[model samples]
Target: MELRNRSAFHEYFFETTYVAGIVLVGTEVKSLRAGKVSFNDAYCQFHKGELYVKNLHISDYAFGTTQRHEPTQERKLLLKKKELRKLEAKIKEKGYTIVPLKIFFNDRNLAKIEIGLGKGKKLYDKRETIKKRDVERDLKRYVK
Candidate 1:
């Protein structure tokens, strides 16, 4: 199952994106496969030179045993050292932050997440985005 954080697109202008593997527990994997995840207020952070995603809610598996995983715990992300350094450097700059864009399973059945380096949008920018979307929808409907 592929899940996207649509609100992230509305709030930030993404400059670059990276697909990284996630560190998940047993129940977490099952929950993800079952599409029981939420990206509310989820974002990425750097800790001790490693990348980790915080506030990502992967719900508990319905049939899981008593040893359930925490839904909003911080989870590590796997990426190359070079890429991590690049993201870290960019994050050090003003107005640059890391946001979780989407999550999907690769062909190998491994869970992966797309993270983006983005800058927050201003009020007018957000309005323009909404206006553009409305225009596109109207145009598509007219053509159909």
Candidate 2:
């Protein structure tokens, strides 16, 4: 499957899990199917025991008028209660965050979002990651 924008892996280290079932407006779903969505700067937050995604941009459907949904409004994420509890606990103890990794359609034609449990990386850690990536790239070129 093709991936859209990926957050800087150097900036956030993730432990990921797959989650299913998110409610979206008709326009949003249509925009997504047309590949007019952006995950950049999007993040997940827990509110009143439910998870919500904020700052995700789903562009307006061309056929839609002013009634079209806002591009960056908060969207609810569907997850089990037990899983929510587990995520809450881990976030509290480990200072981790939830982020949307990817959005895709499953075989059933349902929209699914892949979320990740992650920790923010420090400045030095980011530099280290960049250095490692450069080295890997160099190695690949040399091998070729």
Candidate 3:
């Protein structure tokens, strides 16, 4: 995995997920392979009937020329019409959001992002998750 939004799991309960292709420039792809990406504060939104991810940061490739792509540009996401419509419907629901969960390369060496339709978790729910994680960590240490 090139990048992950760990906060997404803690802040929201994912109800649906979709694997979408990201449009990228050459330098951006190189940066991804070098593990220089951040999904923090990233989100998906529809513009002119197309899905795009905003605030995703793919750092410039170190060896790139002056044509290096911007790190925080809005990138278009490739999804089928049916999936897009489904997501649009889900998003229209109350308290739901679309967020990028992780970025990775497929067998064809193309970049893809796994985005989720999630509902924001309550404060108590977040605390519960933290407690569960701590318990799991303790259990692992005990086992070892």
Candidate 4:
């Protein structure tokens, strides 16, 4: 199953994307397999030179024991040191942010997050995007 943060595109202009593995526990993995995830208000940030995703909610598994995983806990992202350093350097610049775009399992059945280096869009940019999307829809309808 794949879960996407649809709002990320509307809110940011992505420059580059990276696929990074996530550190998840047993219950969290089960929750992901069940497609119980929310990306609302989720973002990536560096803590002590390591990257972590915050506010990416993975609900507790229904059949879990008393000690269940927290729904909105911060989870570490696994990336190469070179990539991490590059991202950290870019983040130090102005207006650059790390946004989680989607979550999906790889061929090996490991959960991975696709993150993008993006700049937040302005209000006018968002309006233009909407107008363009509406025009595309109209064009497609006309073609059909």
Best by lDDT: 4
**Ranking of all predicted structures according to TM-score, beginning with the best and ending with the worst:** 1, 4, 3, 2
RMSD of each: 0.8, 1.8, 1.3, 0.9
lDDT of 3 by residue, 34-135 (tens): 899888899999988899999999998989997789899999999999999999988888998999999999999999999999999999999999999999
lDDT of each: 0.96, 0.83, 0.92, 0.96
Error of 4 at 102 (Å): 0.4
Ranking by lDDT: 4, 1, 3, 2
Per-candidate clashes, comma-separated = 0, 0, 0, 0
Against the true structure, candidate 2 reaches a TM-score of: 0.89
Q: How accurate is candidate 3 locally (lDDT)?
A: 0.92
Q: Which RMSD does model 1 reach against the true structure?
A: 0.8
lDDT of 2 at 126: 88
- Write the residue-wise lDDT of candidate 4 on 39-108 in tens digits: 9999999999999999999998999997689899999999999999999999999999999999999999
lDDT (Cα, tens digit) per residue for candidate 2, span 1-144: 434446646568887675747789868888888889887888888899889999989999999866689899989999888898998888787668888887888888888888888889999988898899999999999999
What TM-score does candidate 4 reach?
0.97
Model 1, residue 111: C-alpha shift (Å): 0.2
Clashing pairs in 4: none
